[model samples]
Target: MELLKTLPAKEVIYSFSTLNPPVLHIRPGDTVAIETYDCFKNQIQSADQEVAAIDWNEINPATGPIFIEGAEYGDLLKVTIDELEIGTQGVMVTGPELGVMGHRLEQMESKIIPIKDGKAIFNERLHLPLNPMIGVIGVAPEGKPVSCGTPGPHGGNMDTKLITKGATLYFPVFTEGALFALGDFHAAMGDGEVSVSGIEVPGRATVTFDVIKGKHSKFPILQNSDGFAMLVSAMTLDEAVKTAVEETIDLLLPYTDMSVSEITMLMSAAGETQISQVVDPLVTVRFFVPQHVLDSLDIQLFS
Candidate 1:
């Protein structure tokens, strides 16, 4: 295993682009411990800090564009999140013109939540269990540079709460070495990220990387104990949901004897169309299919 620590002065990127040089190189099957800054780059340390004081340029700083030896174009870069270690304090921010309810009357506010014994102390009356997840994670895109705040086929800030420990995320390798990087740790977040922020915190993610030659998904695929989910992002929630359903059907078609209509019906019956986060530049959605459903059909997603 190799460790890539992110010191305060360490270089972090706001976008996922081939233009960015790789900070570290490793072969397939290697476990890397990547340290990361919070979504706000740890600038909002106290509740008294105003959200407007933050440098908008450093909204989401991903740790590294780590180069994987065997990853290449058209291949799949498989990343298994082995573990996540977050800091003691997490921050949440909100204000007018910020999130889903931003238009409502509200001034800028920042909250510093303390983490203790695996729970986030939301307030004096409520303690929520921590569900630490990686908010920004991706490889370089095939096209132009993409902001770290957006989620797309190349994965960026998907903000899916499911991307926690024990989950395996597969990203399409667009460039050689699959220049991958990640940051924006959320100690706890809900679906849709309705407030534009989670319990944002600095953390370290331990992950194992492997290259799956040739085969890759149209979008990223997240696999966890429950099942497999197709991660898709688009300009709008409707578009994202439509694309996710279409891609999910495409993925299942080849593995089953069922016709498109039958598969569509099956999906409607059992699959779940869930939201990741709507606050990003591009909204992300996931179409999930349970393991039991696949098992019943004798279908295996990947060889």
Candidate 2:
């Protein structure tokens, strides 16, 4: 096994863009440990701290624009998340006009939850099990700079709960070196993230990088033990869901001989449409295709 180098969170970026320079450079097979600040940039410490007081410009700080050698446009960057270590305390916030339930709230509120023995102490009476995941993970886009708060083809704040340790995320390379970065660690968060935030915490992520030449997916793909999922984001939830299904079919088309109608029928029978988060500037959704279904068809996701 090779040793891992640590990329400090001291230098962070607000957007994934080609204009941003890389803080670290590594080969395709190299594994690095990346440190990150919480979604709030670790500004909200105590419950007394007001969300309005925090600087809007400092939100969702990603650790790096790491340059992966040999990665180029039209290739796929395979990121295998090997481990995650979060801080002892995590924060959550909700406020007026912030998220889905924001319209019903009169003011902003913040909660400081303690992590103890693998659980988030929501309160004295309620303790939720920790399911640490990365809220923002992405690469530089081909054109304009994308904020860390949005999710798109370049993969920003998807806020998917499944992007945890042991999962592999694939991003389409749009520029030289891939220029990847990630942040916004969540101690635990449910689907929809209707509250505008999760148990946000500062953490470190250990990930291994690999480049797959001559192939790429239109959208980011999250792969776990069970199967592969197509992550798509759009201005509306309905649009995101529809795009996810369409992209999934497009990915399957090249590997199988099934017609579009046949694949659509199979998806209706075995696929799952799930939400990643609804609070971001764009809503994210994922369409999952089970591993068994692909296996039965003799299909390989990246082959």
Candidate 3:
């Protein structure tokens, strides 16, 4: 298996403009490490940089292009979170997408958090621990490419901070080599990401990869170490949530003993689903089930 020699900060792409994304090469099971910078592309580091220095054309930049050998269209790529380090100074702010998002900034607040012992000091006033998450991660689409701002089946701007270590993310491969890229590291982000920002910081993170041949997924789903399944719904808040709940069942059934019919019956009887976010234009549904329930299941997700 070949390895990624290194991930350089200067090599990171500052823009997103494609449908058939650029190819990123990598082995299926290899772990790749990356260094993340603050979302403003070093605005904070420059001290003189304006808080709104982010030009409309240039915003969040992701570090990647890791290719998975043998990956092809109609396949599923599994990404595992291994490590995420949040910088000492984290910034949270109101995003320009607010008016369109129909949410008020009154409830929004700016915070500077310090990371120590894998925890966050939300403000000089209080503490809010976190589960560092990659706000953007995706591959190219078939025939066309997508931007880094939109989170979809290809995975981008998920903003789900709970995608911490020990979780696996599944994405549909729409191109050869699965041109994967990721950026926008958030120290901690609230649901719906209403303010359009989180504890945006730069740090070094690690991830492992797994590839499944001849299988595809409509959207991304994550299964946590604790037996919880999260179905991500992106686009239109309402649609995002509805999509997440339905997909949660899709993720749950495969890991359960119940046949498709049985699973349907169980849902009709008493099933559970919870909304994880509504602000990212990406909603996540966390399906909780006991290990005993998954123990006897013969189901499998993705096909």
Q: Which number leads on lDDT?
A: 2
Worst 10 residues of 1 by lDDT: 1-10
TM-score of each: 0.96, 0.98, 0.81
Q: Which stretches of candidate 3 lie above 4 Å from their native place?
A: 1-4, 14-24, 45-49, 95-111, 228-230, 248-262, 268-272, 281-291, 298-303
The number of the candidate with the highest TM-score is: 2
lDDT of 1: 0.91
Which is the winner by lDDT between candidate 2 and candidate 3? Answer: 2
Clashes of each: 0, 0, 18
* Poorest stretch of ten by lDDT in candidate 3: 14-23
- As a whole number from 0 to 100, the lDDT of residue 33 in candidate 2 is 97
What is the per-residue lDDT of model 3 for residues 1-303, given as tens digits with 9 covering 90 to 100?
Answer: 565445665546543333334434568788887776667665554334455555555567777666788887888988888887667777765634452353434433345567766667764666777767778777665554455665667677666665777777888887777777778888776655655677788877788888898766677667675554545555555665556556666767545556877776665555556555555544544444434445446444553
Give residue 95's error in model 3 in angstroms: 5.9
Cα-based lDDT for every prediction: 0.91, 0.94, 0.65
lDDT of 1 by residue, 1-303 (tens): 435533231669899998899988888988888888898888989877777878988889998899999789999999999988999999998889888989993788899999998999999989999899999999999889999998889999999999999999999999999999999999999999998999999999889999999797989999998989999999998999999999999999999899999999999999999999989888999999999998898887677
Candidate 3: what lDDT? 0.65
